[model samples]
Target: MPKAIYAIWWDPNLGPFLGRSYPENDPLTSEEAVVIFMGHGLQQEAKVGYTKLAKGLVVSYLDSPNCIAVLLDENDDPSVVERNLLRLVGRINFNSSKWDAEITRAFLLLQELIAETSGQELLSNPHVTRLVEDMATGRVSALVPRHVLRATAKYPKASDYLGPDEEEVSRLLKDLERAGHLVPKTYGRRVECRQCGGTEVTLELACPSCGSNDIYKVYLVFCPKCGNRTQTVLVDDLTEVRCQQCKQPAKVSELSVIDVELLCKGCGQATNDPKIVLSCANCGKHMTNTDLLGGTGLAYYPA
Candidate 1:
């Protein structure tokens, strides 16, 4: 990290500025120099690109919605300055619009990242490191929509830099979700192959007892005289139902409907529950719910 000698926040549309000189007070009006340099930067027409200051002097550039930030530091390593600049950009983008009260928050974030000790530690995490680098490299958009993270992970070389495996990537996402850094969305339950981690697993409703896939939805009717519970057979123009086991009238009542379950066509055994099983297309292994990895559809941004 570099020691910032001066920092400026400018609204390009309004030409007003906020800036400070650190360690020693400069005699210039609060933002006179800041606005001049910011205008000089705009003449270049690049959204975010840095230029050389006089010998040994360094400056960083960041552009947000209708606003621009410039930092003056003593450090000359362009890579280090750009990394810090990109990290600041990430924070501004995450907080949304940069106008209004958010301007103060944005600058505070920038100062914290450059000055705080934890900010250095955060750069050690692989995910954070990659995200900051991606922002700096223009590989990702400045405003991070929620779904982009997952889509980015599918890109080549992303998984290697982000996680040891896809499962661990999913786990890291879950942790981000817990920390409120992610916006969550619902998705249909998808199962991956336990053996190969392939996503071509087909979900099927199977019998809980006999593990048969040939089952249809039916109402279970209970019998009083025989104490038996079984699937109901439609009779009398579908006006009445009879017990499959005892062939007796199984009246439709709350008490008579013991348990609605799946009936295995192969074994004729009635079970009140069915297994929501996954069959891996690649590995040929049947996976139960517990064996599957669950993923959430989400959008992620730094918080």
Candidate 2:
């Protein structure tokens, strides 16, 4: 199966708007979409082909003048992938305002077609069978991620979606996808702690000088006439700053406002840039952005 499928549309003035991705939250960014649109020569005319990227094979089809669909897969058979992609594209109504709902319906149809074409057997696993039954009976619309760091660590189970444990539910969902009954979508990415392999991480802005999290924003009102500076005070229905040294009330426009500086309470140091630290709630490990491990989050939906 393809790792992901993307639907992209171009505006004559807006460049490209990524309409949707199967796993609704695929990590493919807007800039990468533009690169794909240009790199695959999709702007000139309608075409269908595959190109190998550093990550995987990108099979793209410009189904219309302003719209294109792509499948990111590592399958060796580009022709087979192209054929399957065309089958999906043919069912989508690109002109519809409700493009999201239209594309989702198309995916369901595509799954049914693929299952029939491959003569795939129905899933017989009891756990997955019950999950499918629940879906069919309207008990569950989708299997949602229980936590923000769901993709980073396996310790947190998707207990909210189903009664079973996370690992068991995940394995069952994979079986459903392999059997052509479910589809996976990328939702977002989360950071993991390298020290303990935990996803419960919190971000904090520490003082660059003292490495303390006791930092706060300060609003200072500066009188340009007298070169006097004073902390701003709260007054009802006031639109001006009264300089304490100058003893004059002037319009705020006449005074320079320095509100961008972040003051550290620990060291009394003021700076605009603070060091970003990621602290793990599990192991109490602190790390920088480069030291954290990243993982992709996914959610499952019925095909």
Q: Pick the candidate with the highest lDDT.
A: 2
Q: In model 2, which residue pairs have backbone atoms overlapping below 3 Å?
A: 23-185, 25-186
Query: lDDT tens string, model 1, 1-303?
Result: 343333444555764455433332332343454443554344433334443433234444534323333445454345444444555655554344434445455556656654431335545676757855664566653332222312222322335456555544543444444434443455434454445444555668888877788875566666765777776643244545666677776445433665566667888876766787667654557866644646433434444
Q: Model 1, poorest ten-residue lDDT window?
A: 144-153
Clashes of 1: 1
Candidate 2: tens digits of C-alpha lDDT, residues 117-170: 332343443445566677767677766665443333231323444344555455
- TM-score, candidate number 2: 0.35
The runs of at least 3 residues in candidate 1 whose Cα sits more than 4 Å from the true structure, single-residue gaps closed, are: 5-16, 19-44, 51-58, 62-73, 92-155, 163-303
The C-alpha stretches of model 2 lying farther than 4 A from their native spots are 39-43, 53-55, 119-303
**What are the models' TM-scores?**
0.30, 0.35
CA-only RMSD, every prediction: 18.1, 20.4
lDDT for each of the candidates? 0.49, 0.61
* Model 1 global lDDT (CA atoms, 0 to 1): 0.49
